[model samples]
Target: MEPNRTRLIGEYIVGPRIGSGSFAVVWRARHRQLGIEVAVKEIDKKLLSPKVSDNLLKEISILSTISHPNIIRFFEAIETREKIYLVLEYCDGGDLAAYIHKHGKVSEAVARHFMRQLGISIFTFWLFIFDQISSAGLQVLQEKHLIHRDLKPQNLLVSTNEVTPVLKIGDFGFARSLTPQDLADTLCGSPLYMAPEIIQNHKYDAKADLWSVGAILFQLVTGKPPFDGSNQLQLFQNILTSTELRFPPGAIEELHPDCVDLCRCLLRQNPVERITFKEFFNHRFLGELR
Candidate 1:
């Protein structure tokens, strides 16, 4: 319906779907003016109700506020009755999950290279490392008071050159801004990555990102998700009560002990026990970059 604005949105014609999720589809596009390449995130309005629409706009608002080299740049929002288009910086490499799926477990060299690049970007953005990557990222966000309720592997984008998989954390449909007095109760994010407190339907905050990031770290090294069940209830129960912090044998031998420790601290069942970005920044696992 917004075909009129296609000239404003991009020069590159809309090709077949490059990627998609429950809420939107991403297409490779070219800037009509600059004749430059870009990605257009087309969000279907029909898929969302009024409440959902508000949340989607909130995500757009958050994306609009943030500017980081490692984070994908969200240019503008173009809306029509049928669709909502978000013009974003294109990443030819696709997502990290797709890369991992095609390559199996990543080589130690590749993982470290990716981590170090992210470490620098993360340092530059928030200049802190919380219990986990997203958590550390959240510290900067919390300071600004933004909480990303959904954090997962699929949410992270990569570059084709692999110079750095610009960790463009996407899908903020469940995100919210918080205040000192705010106490969140909604349970969101992938069940396998949800924290125990969240699964209990208890009050929590951005600290919940730590749990999801921890799960992501484990999956990064092991190539297997930590939890899976036949049903949603079963998955929630496992996420809520499971006690094991298992990692593949000999996995840590290649990675620094500090990395393992960091993962453990991030994955801690007790949110209180979860490491803070301040402490995590001082961690040796992150390398002595500082």
Candidate 2:
């Protein structure tokens, strides 16, 4: 009744469960002949609702088509009448959220290192240089007209053992292809790092990602988010209009003023006024990029 729980889709044997969400279950798996480790996510056939299965399929389709160092490299996927199988590369370090939670906050040097790694990821994108892993990802996304709706600390995955860090973006489940319908009201993503436009149900685009980056950068510097509240309404209110999230004097003293200035430009309420990917690429904060 539970299907072949002991088996795998092809050569990968389903092992211990790694994580489970409302829509799917992730398991640590191994390839029989290749002897390679992999993460297998299976969509529950019974609970397939709200077209989640379709979403999983779409994610697989896109991931399969695109190849970037920063993007999660898709291993393989299988579909049957009863279920769907997605085999992904295993990241030993896990998500960035776990790392941040373990260590109160990341250091300024480490934050820049992460950004550099992310830049390298977009290197292979259409408009970016292929075979390079240190180019800015935001620039590539802008060229492709794609907006990463969910950009948070947790979504980043680090893969190196160095003190600075080498990172990549993961989890495309909440991603959506921009369309005419997207020009309307629909607010999605975690609240802690959400932008004012998203909080007010206003039309948003790629600029929403800049706001999220600000929140992540804030947490990296202050060890906490810009706003904190026990309830949803209060949190939403703070994110929508509270400008008190500015950097504490003590915190800014530890880093260059340009870093703080860049955060402000990116987090600006008017999406039109927010920092552009090209501008960010040329900002003094990214001195090396310029």
Best by lDDT: 2
**lDDT of model 2, residue 21:** 75
Candidate 1 residue-wise lDDT, 1-290, digit = tens = 46444444434566557888777888888765577777898989889889778988898888888766556778888888788998888878888778778767765456554554333324343443453333224455656777777777777777674634545566677889887578798867778788888888889976787677667766776676667778989887766676867677777676667667777887888888887655655556556553
Q: What is the C-alpha RMSD of each candidate to the true structure, in Å?
A: 4.8, 3.5
Q: Residues 133-212, candidate 2, lDDT per residue (tens digit)? A: 44455545555555667788777766644455556676776565664235524677789888888888888877787788
Clash numbers, per candidate: 8, 5
- Candidate 2: lDDT over CA atoms? 0.71
lDDT over C-alpha atoms for residue 154 of model 1: 74
lDDT by candidate, in order shown:
0.70, 0.71
User: Ten-residue segment with the worst summed lDDT in candidate 1?
Assistant: 117-126
lDDT value, candidate 1, whole model? 0.70
Residue 17 C-alpha lDDT in model 1: 70
* Regions of candidate 1 where Cα sits further than 4 Å from its true position: 1-12, 107-139, 161-164, 252-255
Model 1 CA lDDT for position 99 = 72
Query: Alpha carbon lDDT of residue 38, candidate 1?
Result: 78
